[model samples]
Target: MNQYPLWKNLLILGVVLFGILFALPNVFSQDPSIEVSAARGHEVTEATPDEVRAVLQNVGVPFKAVEPLAEDKVLVRFPSSGDQLRGQEAIEAHLADRYNSALTLVADLPGWLRAIDAQPMYLGLDLRGGIQVLIDVDMEAALEQGLERYTGDIRSLLRQEKIRYLTVMNDANRVTVKFGDAETLDKGRKLIDREFRELEFETASDGKNFDLYARLAPAEEEQLRDFALQQNITTLRNRVNALGVAEPIVQRQGERRIVVQLPGAQDPARLKEILGATATLEFRLVDTEGSVQDAVEGRVPVSSRLYYDREGRPVLLKRSVIVTGDQITNATSGFDQNSGTPAVFVNLDSRGARRMREVTTENVGKPMAVVFIENRTVTEMVDGEPVKRQVRTEEVISVANIREPFGRRFQTSGLDSSEEAHNLALFLRAGALAAPIQIVEERTIGPSLGQENIDQGVKSVVYGLAAVLIFMGLYYRIFGLVADLVLLTNLVLIVAILSLLQATLTLPGIAGIVLTMGMAVDANVLIFERIREELRNGSSPQASINAGYGKALSTIVDANITTLIAAVILFSFGTGPVKGFAVTLSVGIFTSMFTAILGSRAVVNLIYGGRRLSKLAI
Candidate 1:
């Protein structure tokens, strides 16, 4: 009556084995290593390992292994962190122009385990040493840029329609266009009202000149702000992915700020470079009529601007942009078919493709320049004082003749090397941020401190488990041992599920596990005490055991269900560490219920189910 069926026993055994297989990966430790990747056009071939070995040999640094990785990367493992750092520096210095090296900790799991893609659970930034940054988006600047674009579009529209205007000016919040007479002003106002539904136009006149002012509607402004924030978040996420950071966090904080946490990121400076710089692309017509020498001498043309190339050669380009980086949907680096030179293939969105077609069709045989613009901050000495200055650099990366009208896809050549092409493609793929962001706060957690946290957390779990195990083994004797075994299994199951789900673990999560250990025994205690009560009422051993579990099932379910509800609520509403705690608690509740009721009962039935006993152990 108390024994489980053969199928149920097999099913329980299968689950236990499944949990063990997934939980086994955590036993393997990570190794200190240096990851070597091609900077741009370079490739890490089989010979790359030999080259790295030579470099490390020359530097007198010993390495455990030099292995080739996918995607033109290499991994150089060392026995210690000191050797890892030394080897990384030596490699970087020797191949500064060709390769980029970063120190990292890679999992040293067996090939067979990795074949199934088994991995340990990801740890949060607090548990894994890494960098944390808080970036503040410049919403005011974004609004201003949007208004400026609208002002330019309005001017172009009026000119295209042959509507004459005396002057056009854009202030912080409004664009004003002055016409010579009321008739022209009325015609312009009607045209704007018909074409631009997002703008609200106001008309004023002082008898001589008529003026029409256009301002973005309130709803439109809010939408623009929201779009800007969302776009910046997406751009940052893309950049982080390109960096190949594992388990990075790029999330919005409040309305205009973003919090980025990069766990296991080795080089914080490189991360800052990737996150801080705003790189963008613009296609503009090369102004053949304007002399670069004239513009360089400060006599720039009204309709053209001068920019330098990567080699410091100046070229004149038109002020009007044909298309911006935002229109690019995809980009990749490859070789030109005929010349075999490094080139970037770009694919634009539908709107951008149409615009490109129109522009190229009108200006066939003319040269168009692909301009690379970067906005960065640097510290410069001014009057013997170090001052932070914002610098803007614009360079023409490619200038090619428009042989035929094309859209959607095109190739840009003239890149100096494959590395340049690769870097350009990476930048284009990441896209440009909609608004500028400044890092307002920064923090770095050292690995030693992170290790300390892990040590303490592990100690807490060990101590808590030991205390509970001893208490259970002494209090109820044999049945208590059964509960302890189930409790241990419950912990293993929780970890296996976490690893399978790839949930990040934090300190509070460890606390949740400890709390779960205590609660896991509660259900067993309820059942045991119920059995004792039945035995006191003169029931037989097997009958008392059956009565105990049957009577206690409803109460255990009710108690656990209520706690599970609270855990779910916490996970839904809480953020960061709180959510981590809630997740562990919620997962623990389910596993504990399974092990306590079904697992404990299965073992008990095996031990005492069919045997006729005069008295119980309790």
Candidate 2:
């Protein structure tokens, strides 16, 4: 029985410790890989897998493969190369393709992992030197978008019904449609209610005059706001993920704010260029017959101006905007056979198609333009190049008069190259942010800072372990050495389990391990002290050892139970790094209890078995 327990304890400890040591290489080893993290104005967040793929695709970089980690992160590895940037560019382009956003280049691991390489644990931004971006999604912007949508729907409905109105304007966040009679107003209100279930209306009548105000209900407003926030977070995640940044933290902070953390971002300027821009595409109708001539001749239409040279770019005349970018569902890059150059293929929804048909039919054989806006401003081409536009209809979908639903997949052909088309597709897919977001807070940690944290964390663990070992050995003597052996064994088992789980080690987690190391000796101390007490009462050595373990068992269970309860509470309430610490601590406590109680008992039994002891050391 003694041989069995001793062998069992040794076998368990050896298997766990050896398992961790063996698996370490696979988890942390750098196999010609690229990792990305973002930095914006001193804020850093790790890039998601999608973000990393985007960067790689955008830059035409090649990767062997890409693997995803939980929490919007990725692992990217490239073939060994002399040009690291080239590999990075490939990864960046992949990220952009997948996420449609730029990537912030993170750390490039050494060709191999050495003995001193960081433990396979989550390195928090505070310890890893990264970026933190706190974005406040603009509520006003989301409201404006919703309002615009409502207005567009109203106009289309009126046009379809052929109801003429004198003034149709959206002012003060309310769509004011003045019809010739109250009957028309009543009809319009009912039509709106039928289409938009989320809309709320208040009607006012003064004699024959009438006005209707349409708005969102309180519950609907809250829902809309939440949707807007989620969209913002999603978009941000997409963009950051595209950048090939590693381990980015993108999360909704409050009602209308998001927090992004990039663990390794080198270029802040590039991050700003990618994150701050709002890419929007619109199709405006052209009044080809009389636009430039009449406007220059002082015949400007109401609410429309003839810009001879608008935004200091071109001399193009347009009458009224037919459709906003919101109607566009998808855009892709393709080629026009006639010109043999690059082009973008664009797709619209049913409403957009109908509007396109009407506008194109009305202005056949005329010049039209597709306006691309970034951040509410039109993006101007540096060179004045001829850009052709096409308007598609139902005929394009169901050719030969066959009835077919329009395919969701549409192309935006006629771009210069695959890159341009890809970029456009990315932009369209990203769509308009449900709201505008402003960075309210940002913090950037440097690589040096991360290194410093590592240094301090290691120092604490070393000192803490040393102090514990010294105190245990001096107080418990021979039994203390056995306990110390168990304590070291406890660390090995904890790390093995952590590695097996692929858990990230944060600074607090290091403290947790240190605490576990200190407490590992508690059970052994209990048993050894009890044995000494028994020896003073003239008990035999074997009897003393048995008595000591039996007496200590109840105390160990009570103490460990309280510790386990606290660990569970910490884990439940904590987030990110704190949670990691709690997990490691809890795991450590359980392992320590097993090794300390069972392991120490096995060791004492081996020492005292089948032997008559002359004296028992106290």
Best by lDDT: 1
Q: What is the C-alpha lDDT of each candidate?
A: 0.83, 0.61
The clash count for each model shown is 3, 73
Which sections of candidate 1 miss by over 4 Å?
Answer: 41-63, 80-98, 134-144, 166-230, 238-247, 251-258, 264-279, 283-298, 307-316, 326-431, 437-445
| Residue 509 lDDT in candidate 1 | 88
The residue-by-residue lDDT of candidate 1 on 188-249, one tens digit each, is 99997888899999999989869999998999888888988999889888888798765577
- Residues 1-618 of candidate 2: C-alpha lDDT, one tens digit per residue: 223455686786576557457445434433344444332112223546555566566666677666753423355556543233475444433332232122222333333534445334445566655567677787876776777667767777778888766555566877666666788778878887888778788777776667777876778777778988987777767766666554456888877888887654433434544555555555554444556556667876543434422133332334345555555676666676666666666677777787767766655656555555444211122333222121211101100111232233333332335644555556666555676666666554434456678789879987888888888778777777778777877877787777556465678888899888867777787888888899989988778888888888899899988998999999898766777779889989888987888766666667766687786544
Q: Write down the TM-score of every candidate.
A: 0.76, 0.58
- C-alpha RMSD of each candidate structure in angstroms: 5.6, 11.0
Candidate 1's clash total is 3
Estimate the TM-score for candidate 1.
0.76
